[model samples]
Target: MISATELPSTRPYLIRALYDWCSENGFTPYVAVKVDASVQVPREYVQGGEIVLNVSMDATSSLKLGNDFIEFKARFGGKPRDIMVPIQRVMAIYARENGQGMAFPVNDDEVSSTPLTAVQPEPVQSLPEDDPTPTSPSPSRPALKRIK
Candidate 1:
């Protein structure tokens, strides 16, 4: 029984909306509140580095439910725990740079509150004019043939 007023954040409405969505869809919405540095990088997470997430819930719903928050937990190679996230406690709800992050913005009905804009870092490009030397040398061969 979390209060909308007690939740210290400007984005309380957004979090509430997410919670409702999760409840309706048989899931739990846990945003990143804190990160653990001593965790190991699982074999599956080799491509993408592991990120510790502090999932918030009204109760120990995540552990009791089990199925919810699987995607986030597995991606970071960690087991879900009972955590409470105040609206103001959330620093970032990041998934990844590969078009896989979650952002919540203030909305009218809370439906449009989730941050749809994924901040994917642009791919790096190489310069074409890096090589100063030409592929083929000029036809001016010095002393090609010396017939004595």
Candidate 2:
């Protein structure tokens, strides 16, 4: 049995929340995923081992955002395709219009060390309180501003 302290990653829940937020605000939600053998996406559309998908209602059909994976039927090049993406493979989920979203870190070493089947889901935890104000801006990346 998994201990309570060994909680499941909040990535999936965050993704779902952001997706809902985008949809509610009439913004398009996009997910950036790292493609691997486990990901069922169009190889041709995947660029540099990564693919960004629009998870909006019109783009996807019968989209099931599960705890471990997101499964949906989408049209690619005018052909219907079933897409499956592991929550672990999801790097980021954001709105296309304002670039407001969250990014999850990817540890290449951990990916190589662990097997996908060994992964398990636990209960979700609450996020800690943090100031929304931006302190300093890094030159490499743009600063994130909270949207109303």
Candidate 3:
């Protein structure tokens, strides 16, 4: 018999499912990623040590949402750049329009967020105007908040 620890994590699967949901519902899919050395993205666009990516079909090309990594080519500031993010590094996946999504546990040395049942709303800074990768509009983005 296999131990529970040996079981595969549902993170990647959930990520793919949410992506599909957003795509089918005409919602723009965005992923909040915790940046570190392992994450490959434009450093200039990162804010508060995190970056939100627009993974919608219209935003990315050659996008591959894999079990271990999400690979894609996107344009930032009119320059094409290759973006890669580890599955575990994704802190949250939510729709840019409705602000509904899931938050995942991030095991980071500098910062950490506990797993939650659903996303909570909070004010977050907007992304740079010139940067192609952007967070949700209206200064509002899904946030991970502890509910007691």
lDDT of model 2 at residue 144? 33
* Residue 114 Cα positional deviation in candidate 2, in Å, after optimal superposition: 5.0
| C-alpha TM-score for every candidate | 0.28, 0.73, 0.75
C-alpha local distance difference test of each model: 0.34, 0.78, 0.82
Worst 10 residues of 2 by lDDT: 139-148
Q: Write the per-residue lDDT of candidate 2 for residues 96-133, one digit (tens) a residue.
A: 89998987655444553242333333344444568555
lDDT against true structure, model 3: 0.82
Backbone clash total, candidate 3: 0
Which residue pairs collide, candidate 1?
A: 103-115, 104-115
Backbone clashes under 3 angstroms, per model: 2, 0, 0
Which TM-score value belongs to model 1?
A: 0.28
Candidate 2 lDDT for residue 84: 94
Candidate 1 ranges beyond 4 A from true positions: 1-9, 35-84, 92-148
Off by over 4 Å in 3: 110-148
lDDT per residue (tens digit) for residues 1-148 in model 1: 8754444343445544554556555554444432223222233422223233423343333332121112222323346433322233233343222222345331222222233232233344444697665454333311111111
lDDT of each residue in 1-148, candidate 3, tens digit only: 9755566678889999999999999999899998988899999998888899999999999999987789999999999999999887888888988888898767665332322222334557767789888655542343553221
Q: Which candidate number has the best lDDT?
A: 3
